[model samples]
Target: MVYKMSVYYRATMCITLMLLLLNLCEKGYGVNLRDMQVPCEEVYMVKEGETLNSISEKCGDPFIIEENPHINDPDDVFPGLIIKITPFRLYSYKF
Candidate 1:
């Protein structure tokens, strides 16, 4: 009778430990993930010699204008030329 009781108690302890571990696994590290979805917006032209970096600092993320690499030579932008700052992909996931 004593041996049966001991075996039963050990089984109960193992089951309890398994349940606690399962509970901890279910409540994983709580981190809220977010998708950075910013929309495109327009920005007015600045005076000559202004740079994209400077404009980004003043305007903010998802910067006011999307510069076209094809036409917008970083070294040669003219004043009064409007530019479209379109939404561009910023991140990717691989698995």
Candidate 2:
């Protein structure tokens, strides 16, 4: 009788925990990529008053210097300067 009761209790606990986890997941507890506005362009032209860091954040590309080898200097960016943009979010699955 005791053995049967213990098994029943364990099964009930497992089911309860699974329900709690499902509830948390439904409440938006993880990354929802659908809500993000990721840029689709592979090439981008720098606009006036925009720095590399600002462009990185705006375009979602974190490795602007590595992608664009022509940028001899990070601070030499100017309006009409074309640069390659590959968003970091696209390769996030590798990690």
Q: Best-fitting candidate, measured by lDDT?
A: 2
lDDT of 1 by residue, 1-95 (tens): 99999999999999999999766645652321233344334545656777666655544544443345445455566777666564453432322
- The sequence of per-residue lDDT tens digits that candidate 2 reaches over residues 1-95 is 99999999999999999999777656666644455455647778899999999999887778999989999999999999998898544422211
Task: Provide the clashing-pair count of each candidate structure.
Answer: 3, 0
lDDT of 2: 0.81
Candidate 2, residue 27: Cα displacement in angstroms equals 15
Worst 10 residues of 2 by lDDT: 86-95
Please state every model's RMSD to the true fold in angstroms: 11.5, 7.1
Q: Once model 2 is optimally superposed onto the true structure by TM-score, how far is the C-alpha of residue 11 displaced, in angstroms?
A: 33
Q: What's model 1's overall lDDT?
A: 0.57
C-alpha TM-scores of all predictions:
0.33, 0.52
Give the residue spans of candidate 2 off by over 4 A. Answer: 1-36, 88-95
